[model samples]
Target: MKTVAFYRIGMIICTSSILLLLISSLIYNLLPDNDIPQMLLLRDDNGRIIGDAPFAPSWQFPFGTDREGYDIGYKLLEGAVYTIGAAIIISLLSFIVAFGIGIIGGFSKFRVKSFAHKFFTSFYFIPQSIIAYNILYPVIWEPMEGFTTTLSERIVIEVLVLAIITVPTTAILISNETEQILGEEFITSATVLGGSPLFIFYKHVLPHLKMRLFIIYPKIVIQMLLIIAHLGFFTLYFGGTDVCYTPFCHPPKPFIQEWSGMMGTSYKELGLSWWIFMGPLLCFTVTTLLLNGIVKCIEGLIDHEPYKSKQTSRENETHSFESHSKQEKFLFIKN
Candidate 1:
């Protein structure tokens, strides 16, 4: 009961927060001028300027302001859609690709399953983040002239790369799980009862896999978030990284204010204006924790031990009721 309560509470809070962030960001961007201040300065009672940009956390700006005077809190709110939404999309695409391949490989002959397992398992040796960075670097980084691809194109490329890189190990794991399910006694019984592979998978394996899939999805999202953060540290922002070679030009910046992009762009100011980077870092930390919490909730909710015990108790009760019915019928016959 406690676990179930936590699951409900955790889901509600997480879902509500994400919806709020996405909706607020949408409305904020939909304004005519899309007016969000680029700079802000603090003033005293007499209206004399007291402080410049990069203010500490205060009532006026809860998460404080960056060197450029943009509100860190508002930037986080606006970028929530990009960071969270993109991660969700990438994770979902990978899961879908993995699912199809795994289902096919799982239902195949032993040789096919073994080949898939051995082949795809090798992908685990590759460092996903490093490989992703190497592949995505050229296209996502602006050239001396300008970006060859548009922001949308770059984003799509990144998504494909990220999703494709993760499919190997995930598909292998899914295939293995499917094989295990296929080996179950019930699966054998179904097969003996003339159930086809397709029918058995749909009726038996799928129901069992559903809970695991739900649990795995959040884990994949967590991996994606970590990958995005790592890519940011590697100076590969989600959309594009603009490197300014001009002497007086500001440091390299991401095209968007996504959380990873924000972290990448602001890390240089860690010494003096730590808040600039820490603001986004804090948001990332919190979001990761929230996701982990959700994973835990799902884990607790899906624990088979308690459910199995309950199922056993119900079966026992049914047996006892049947025995009692037979005794009453015999007593009536003898009477």
Candidate 2:
């Protein structure tokens, strides 16, 4: 009960946070103009550029401002959609690839399954971040001729690359689960009864796969988030990286203002204004916790075998009683 309650609480908090982000994203996008100020030109009586300098946390700006005077809070709000949306898209795409491969491969002959297992296993040892960065670099890196890729194109490519990288691991997991399900007596009985493989799969396998997907989907999202963050730490931001060649090669900046990129870009300023990086870091940490909470909720919903067993037992008892009562009534009426 305690465990169940914890999961419930976590679900509420996480769901709320996710919903809040979605709403904020919606509102931010709906606004006519939501651009971050590259330089908020404010001056004192002495005619100094006060706004360009970083400021500590204050009542006016709760989260503080960065070196360029961009509001950390506002940037977080703007970037929330990109960060969360990218993770979601990557997770869904990965799941789609995994589901197709896992189901087909799991149901395939032993030789096919063995081949696939070996193929995917070979890539599993490689780090996901490295794979993602390598896959994304060519597409995201700006060439000397100037910007060729649009934001949408870069984002789409990044999502696809991220999704593709996870397919092997996710497919392996799904294949294992499907194999276990195939070994069940019902599946064997269906096969013996002359049910076609497709028929049996549709009737008996898809439902189980759906339930498994519910539990695994959030985990995939979390994994993608970690990978994105890792890539950001290496200065490979989502969308693309913009490099300035003038004046001793400035650090590459993210095309879009994402939370991970925010942390990466502002990491150098931690000594002067810790809040710049801390705001996004806190956002990432909280979002991760909330996602973990969601995972726990999913586990709680699907993992309670004892409760399911008890419910099934009670249902069987009720059906038996109903049948017995009907028979007794029929006998009495005949008499």
Give the best candidate by lDDT.
1
lDDT score, candidate 2, position 209:
67
Worst 10 residues of 2 by lDDT: 305-314
Please list all clashing residue pairs in model 1, or write none if there are none.
Answer: none
The residue-by-residue lDDT of candidate 2 on 1-335, one tens digit each, is 77777776778888898989978886997799988654456688999867655877788678988877777889999989988888988999999989998898888877667876988897778889998887888887776676787989888888888999999999988988888878887667556655577865765676566667777888898999899998888888888888786788868899888988998898887887899989988888888888887887877866643444335434533554465456653334553
Q: How does each model score on TM-score?
A: 0.86, 0.83
CA error at residue 335 for candidate 1, angstroms: 50
How displaced is residue 262 in candidate 1, in Å?
A: 0.8
**For residues 1-335, what per-residue lDDT tens digits would candidate 1 score against the true structure?**
77677777887787677667778877876778765566577788999998899888788788888887888888888788889889999999999999998888888886666766887788788778998999998988888998878889999999999999999888887888898988887677667655677777766778678778877888889889989999999889989998998899877888887899899878888898888889889988887887787777777777723544345434533554565456653334554
Model 1: what TM-score? 0.86
